[model samples]
Target: MKFFIRTFGCQMNLNESEIMAGLLINDGFEWTENPDEADIIIINSCSVREKAENKMYGAIGGYGKLKEKNKNLIIGIGGCSAEKERDALLDRFKKIDFVFGTRNVIDISNLVKRAMKGERFADFSDKLNEVNYSIPKRPFSKHHAWITIIYGCNKYCTYCIVPYTRGFEKSRPIDDIINEVEEYNKNGFKEITFLGQNVDSYGKDFGDKKPKLDLLIQKSAQFDSIKRIWFMTSYPSDITDSLIDTIAKEKKAAKYIHLPVQSGSNRILKSMNRRYTKEQFIDLVYKIQKEIPEVTISSDIITGFPSETEKDFEETVDLIKKCRFERINIAEYSPREGTVAHKYFEDNVPKHIKNKRLQYIMNLQKKINLEENEKYLGKTLSIIQEGKAGKNNTYMGRTINNKLIIFQSQEKLNGSFLKVKVNKVSPGPLYGEIIEIINNI
Candidate 1:
């Protein structure tokens, strides 16, 4: 049997899809990129944004038409959106055979077996204890892999749906994470990212305020095979001095921080239930920059949030100018059902207004990104070969600070680290030529 998986959302969702594919592959099933030839199809979903939810629904409808031609085709939905609307989804779409939650990925093989036998299933139960620490996975990348250091979120930002869908914070033990890193290392993977919704709050669920992510980074750095360690989607307030110091001191830790500050207006932030104030967030960014001078800071910004005023929108613009983030993921706010904002606050921002705000922020950041990338010109930087760039003999790799550079190389350098001399820079990506390949760091 052939199975096809289409993933949507963040990195965690992508990793979950790999786990599902691994389970199916181990069950005597083949993986296929073309859904038309597959016996089973699964959509790993995201519900953080209404746009993502709509895409998943549209995909289901389009794929559902395939059942008319292929009577034996089995369709499955999993991840945040599926978990969020488990009951409604099955009732809404007859093509869906099985629906599994974020924590229910371990039972994928069993679920597929039952699904093949014509038994419909929806398993959204919390399976924190039942998860296999060393579960089988078919990683998407050969050289870089994501090890989920923590699962779910406790922050429950008013505009977010991750907490309700994925459930509360449940962190894996340090030993288990290290073991996963070792597995990736054995597979010749040079870059390993510690992934989570709120990575900075990794160990708080274990009943300790200690930053276990820092400790995990420290342990993962000990592996000589791993060249870079990275973590992401940090909660601003949870970032500790220890975490900053650990990133600075560890040779393998990637000099990039993805701390999201959703909105800049204090009043709007408060309305959105973000714990930290704008002033505090600014202070934290400055501190991270001061401690790790080479670090490239990235952030997420949401415009036209509920009850946002022209002043609030300006405040966000002002924050962008002040921070000058290497990159800022800008989004127009859409009220998601079951979130605090949806339940209590009104989605009062006009759509046109949201679009205007989003565009302004995007243009501002594009200018800022170009300014930042210009600094790399005429400089030699270290980069690990990620994959082919699809342009002639050029290949793409990321710098230690997470800058993607395209450079020409004749050799197949998927996992090898190399030095590149930057010859061109733009707002999008840096162009360079490989100076020398580093066999070992």
Candidate 2:
């Protein structure tokens, strides 16, 4: 049998899809890139943004048409959006044969078995039945892999749906995570990222001897084969001194921090239940910069929240100018069902206004990106080789601080690390000349 999986949303969703692919491959199924040629079609979707949700529905409809030509084709929906809709998803998407929630990824093989037998199934239970770490996976990058250090989120930010869809914080055992990293290293993978919804709160759910994130980084650094360690999406209030210290002191750990500050206005932040104030967030960014002046700080920002006024929008703009973030992911707020903000707060912000605010923030960030990239002109940057960027021998890679650089080079450096001298700077990517290979990936 052949299966094809289309993934949407965050890195966690991508990871989950990869796991699903692994399970299918182990069940003696081959993967097909084209849905029309596959026996099964799976959509791993996200519901954080209304745009993503609409995409899911549109994809289902398109796949339904494809199913008409192939009578035996089985269609499945999984992840946040599927979990949110639950059993109702089957009713809404009449062509779908099965639905699996985020927590149901462990039983995917069994679900597929039942699905193949013509038994319709919808598993929305909130059980965290995780598969073993040794499962075969089709990793996105041969040299880099993601280790889910923890699962789910506890902070029920009013505007967020991850807490309800993915459930509460469930930290994986440190030994298990370590073993996974070690295995990746042994398999010739040079980079390993520790991932969690809130990585800073990794060991908090467990007993007193809860292993610290710093310890995990330190132990992973001791691995002989691995060259890079990265992590992401730290809650502002959960970041600790030790975490900053580890990143600053450890050579293997990348010097990039992804701490999201949803909004800049204190009133709007409170409305979103973000827990930290704008002043506190600024202070935290300052602290991170103080510890590691060369750190590349990235952030997530949402515009046009419920009751967001022009003054609140101006505050966000002012905050961006003050902090000068290296990179910013801006999103226009859309009320999701079952979230506190959805239930209590009115979606009073006009769509046009929301779009205008989003564009304003993104435009500002583009200038910042250009200015920031300009600073690296004539400086040497260490970059890992990503695949080809375009035709004419154009290749791409990212610096340690997470800046993508496109350069002209004849050498094939797919997974290798090389130092490049920055020649030109633009808003989109850095142009550089390869100098020498640092580590052959």
Candidate 3:
């Protein structure tokens, strides 16, 4: 059997797709990149934004057409969106052979086998901390991999569906995470991103005796094969001084942080249950920037929430201007069915208004980003060459600050570090020419 998996959303979804692929491969299934050549087509989805949700529907519709072409092809939907609306999906898509939730991915192979035998299969949203089902698998990349340090979220932010869909907090054993990293190092992977719903809250599920994130970074840095370590989706409330200090002090840690500040207005934040004020978030950003000069920060911003007024939207714009984020992910709020906001708050913000607000945010961000990139002109940046940038001769890579740079180079530099002097800067990407070769590891 052949299988193809399309993934969307955050790193967690990507990691889940990796595990699902591993399971199928272990079951003697060959992986295919083309959807048309596969016996099974799986979509790992996200529901954070309405756009993502619509994309999932479009993907399903496309698969539905493929099913018409190949009646025997099994279609499966898994991940956040599937878990959130399992029953509705199963009812709507009779052609869908299987639907498994985020929690019980280990059952995929068996479930698909059952579905192939003319049996219907649907398992969505299981209990938290139920079992640790770790499957050994190959990564899509040779140089980088994601290690999921924790699963699920305890924080029920008003607009988020993750807690209900993925269940509560569950931290994998420290030894398990360490063993996985060691194995990746042994296998010649140079970079690992410690993934979680909230990375800062890693060891809290266990007793305080277990080492926290700072200690984990310290231990991972001790390994010679691992050159870069990073963690993502940090919650503002859990981000501590020690974590910032550790990243600044640790040589191997990436100098980028993706701390999400959902809204800048205190009123909107309270409605969203973000737990931190704009002032506090600004202070935290200041601390990080002051402590680590090379550090670049990214943020998640929601433009229009329920009851968000013009003043509230302006506050968000002002806050973004103040922060001057290196990269900002902007989304117009979409209410999930079971979330706190959906039940209590009316979707008062009109579509046009929401879109206008989102545009305002993006427009401001464009100028800020251009200004930030201009600072890098004529400076040497060490970048890990990723691949060819589109059809152009230029190769693409990211600086240690996680800024994307496209530069002209005759030499092939994939999976290696190169030093490039930035000559041109744009809001989209930095255009440079490779001046020197760095570590080829």
Q: Top model by lDDT, which number?
A: 1
Residue 355 of candidate 1: its Cα lDDT?
Answer: 95
Instruction: Give the runs in model 3 whose Cα sits over 4 Å from its true position.
Output: 125-134, 209-211, 409-412
> What overall lDDT goes with each candidate model?
0.88, 0.87, 0.84
lDDT of 2 by residue, 213-311 (tens): 888999999987898888977899988898889989998888888989988999999988889899999998989888985888888999889999999
lDDT of 1 by residue, 303-384 (tens): 8898899999888888888888988888898889988888888888899999999999888889998999999999988998
Give stretches of model 1 more than 4 Å off: none
Q: Put down candidate 3 lDDT per residue, 130-215, tens digits, no spaces.
A: 43435756577777888888888888999998898878778887777787888888887788899988888888878773438877
Top candidate, metric TM-score: 1
Question: What's model 3's TM-score?
Answer: 0.95
Give me the runs in candidate 2 sitting further than 4 Å from their true place: 126-129, 209-211, 439-441
User: How many steric overlaps are in each model, in order?
Assistant: 0, 0, 0
Better structure of 1 and 2 per TM-score: 1
Residue 278: error of model 3 in Å? 1.1
Pairs in clash, predicted candidate 1: none
